[model samples]
Target: MDEVLADPIDKFISLYQRDHGFNYTLEQMHGKEFGELLPEELLPSLRVYLNQKGFFRDLKVIPGAIETVEKLCEKYEVFIVSAATEFPLSLEDKQAWLADHFPFISWTNIIFCGYKIVDVDIMIDDRARNFNPKIGRHLLFTSPHNVGLTEYERVNNWAEVAEKLL
Candidate 1:
């Protein structure tokens, strides 16, 4: 969900700038988690913001995501699999967000769990840890945190995903 279909980093930057009066650019966050760019004392506050209600509700959708995913659905069984159990409040927010943004996807196809243990033949995610190389083809979605990673095939944007999968 995050960094793949949604821009959570934009939310992080907004909240941080609104509270601390300091803005952070995506370049500043390259190859690092948002928290890693903050002062040690501010890390806890970032975590708190993530746990707050509605944090996941209005995230900006990645460019071309809706159109590309909609196209992919024509040829494949699409699922919006998100690791949401960690932030319990986000489950409802994410579901609502998906409903608003990607209404074509069915509720039964969404999976909100801690571990991404699915039997899909192809998985598209920003996190490399979620991929089981032996199980399927994994396409790494480019994000600031995963910029340095080069193990799997990488898709820099949704257009690239469309090019490769559609």
Candidate 2:
């Protein structure tokens, strides 16, 4: 969720990769898409520009995120059901990252997957559409870029976000 805003250009690039069949540097695919679609060559430099401009890591954790999650852990069986894959970041890396940054989470409590829909009490995710009926409740982490999407319980901050679940 935080990454989406911190790197909107990356999101656009990722979307472009999804739409097209190539997964190379923007320069490698230059002159492919016409007009605003993006000049393949310029994408690499644009990415560099975004990085140098500090757009690469500006994601701020929602206020009270830690407190809310900690509180939620007390009342509910809290689990992080994210869409990120285990590649690039291995299980160890993922666990370490979480442990280092989100020390509040118990290692056994976290579940990482590229695709997940387990029979659990509830699920919270940025991609709310991925919520399965098998799960109890769904909370959509609404970001500025995804506000136009329809039909889900959305919350911008974790304080309001906690009320829905616990």
| Cα-based RMSD of candidate 2 | 9.0
- Per-residue lDDT tens digits for candidate 2, residues 16-108, read 567555454545323232223555565565444333423323334455777787788788777665444534334454455556556788867
The best candidate by TM-score is: 1
Give residue 36's error in model 2 in angstroms: 10
lDDT accuracy of residue 106 in candidate 2: 82
Best by lDDT: 1
Model 1, range 59-139, lDDT digits (tens) per residue?
999999999999999999998889999999999999999999999999999999998988899999999999985656899
